[model samples]
Target: KKLDAKVKLWHHNSQGLFDYSTKDFQEYTLKWRGDAFLTKSNNRIQNQPSLPKTPIAKLKANDLALYPGHLFASLCQDLWLVARSFTNGYRLAPGDIVRLGAQAFKVKQICTDKPTNKGFSLTDLLVFQEPSGETSQVHSLPCRVCLSESYSSQNPLISPCNCKGSMKYIHLKCLQQSIKSRVHSTDYSLAFMFKNLSCELCSKQYSSKFYLNGELKDLLEIKNLPQPYVVLESLSCKEQGLYIASFCTKSILSLGRSHQSEVLIKDPSVSRNHAKLVYKGQGIYLKDNKSKYGTTILVKRPISLKENPHLEFQSENSTIQFKASGLVNLLPSCLRQPVAKGPKSPSLPLFPVNKGICLSTDDLDFLVREAQGELLNTSLSFCQDSIQNFEA
Candidate 1:
């Protein structure tokens, strides 16, 4: 009967089980006639029927409550469970529940390899504690930039960089205003006075994006920018953040490591004039400038051979060239009488010729082998003809 009750309860509240909160659990468990303060124990009760253990037995009740609905659901599914088993008797595993008075608590192991609140910073530790749903004195703290404690949903205080104490929290608008003041914007480009998007004191790059109260928010906001602008992001570890450069249809923007280049890349591998972006008509095209380390485009879909007749790509140490020519008509043009010349001939039976295909060193070697075989056949034929004539 207990087993049946448990099965029925699980079936009814399967959806809610994923995003189960303390309030929800308390409310739902009120209807249950079975043991209210139950633990996910592997050892069966002496007389009671068997009950299936909760899949999310590893998560502490407090930590589970702090999780967002999606994260809670993922935890219930055990998506991040490692395959290794905990052999140490001292170490508590998933499904091990402890009873304290009327309430039961589950044990969860959290990695403490990263130190908290050291000489470096306390922002991360404070941020972690902020989601506890408790009213804390931290809310009274003023913004470092504006020196105002007032904050609303429209313009909230955020700890974006690695700064501790009074220098930690700052209003989003104040930070944006500070960034805007340093930014040098012209008709063609927008350049930052600072090398990267980082805090002056901490020397840490500000997070590009962060979530607050389950809502996604951007750290930096650039407003009222010119149209037909291109934003380039550096993949290099040394340089970071988005660099914006605008261009007219007639003008070309040069990209390289040099200071003179319009879009500057501060990497050693990049040449002085690595590449150029040309805006023609409605389309933009990227062309290589014969750099030592050549430019590359990641091809996601099949490209039309007719539109792109010649294509060159670099693979490791070697450069590969692909060329496509007009289809070769195997039947002679004279053999087929010309029907009215419009643009294309339908009667020509066009076939792709090997000459138009991508040729490599292997293809040249195959041609050489064919020539040697033909010479050997010619020599054998000449010898047979001489023998026949001598016999005659």
Candidate 2:
């Protein structure tokens, strides 16, 4: 609280004590490795034909000799043209002209190796002249899609899609038409909503919405109809039958009393077209379709008289219910009686009895007559024996 003072800080050196000072060191000598005269001659030869010989600062000859090709390349301009040609796998021959920067250069000589002993050998090339406007590339490249070199209205080629080289460029109109056709033709499933306009080959989707005109945009709204299996059952029939259908497989099933319906109910209450089992994406929907008696589905079981306890019955119900033991006891005595064993009928001959031989109709008739005669004789003998025994 005693005498508080506010002070400002100084930003720069007030005395200017920080100052510049010059210093020097000895000029160290480097041992020369190659002939200086040859190096000078090579440098002079590399310069432009029209320019006078100009001496540059002396560089370490030994260092330059180690990489003679690199040193020679540093002296020239437009080296990229030759580098590009080499990258493209084009073999350069003498007299081959290369165009670069609005100028044309002819390959004058191809030196396979460097003749000097002081430097490393490189594929030396001597090219002639700079770029000249007199000669130019005249031929135009064609579009891969249309295969057209030029348009009447001079429509320029563009590559909006992910394609490379010759297959890249295409006219705007051609692209639009192609997209329109693809949208109309391709079938969309449940995944259609997430799908975008894409190249069939590359699967690269179209990102630019501006490319989609009104017609194409509207076409995008058309989605593939969902196809699902359905069960069509007739409620009226005592023996209920279910039909499986789908939009993809079977289109529709008409239900009614009429024979024309795919699922005939044979119920008087049902109309000719009582209901239609329509298959939509959501699920199998039951459309009434305006029938005489409206279609209804029982959601729950109804109450019976037994459950109500109000109505009394003494064997009045059509359906009979009994316990397992009581049901067996209630069965008729005739039905419960044991089966009797009777005299066996004469057995017929086995099929194809004699290996490969099969009995004909005449043979079968003869065999039947013989068996009947023998049975009749035996019955007559038995009756006579019974009569004699009874008389005795």
In candidate 2, what are the lDDT values of residues 333-354, reduced to their tens digit? 6654232122221122321111
lDDT of 1: 0.36
Steric clashes per prediction: 0, 2
How do the residues 1-392 of candidate 1 rate in per-residue lDDT, one tens digit apiece? 01111111112232112111122211111112121212222321111112223221111111111111122122221111110111110121112222111112222111211222222111221112122221112467899988999998667787766789999888878887987775545555554444455788887776555565566555445543344444443333443334455554224777677777776655565678766655443333345565544444321111222332333322122222223223334667676323221112111111111111111111323333433443453444433432344335
* Residue 363 of model 1, lDDT score: 31
Best candidate according to lDDT: 1
Clashing pairs in 1: none
Instruction: Give stretches of model 1 more than 4 Å off.
Output: 1-167, 171-174, 177-186, 191-223, 248-250, 303-309, 322-392
Clashes of 1: 0
Instruction: Estimate the Cα RMSD of every predicted model relative to the unseen true structure.
Output: 31.2, 52.7
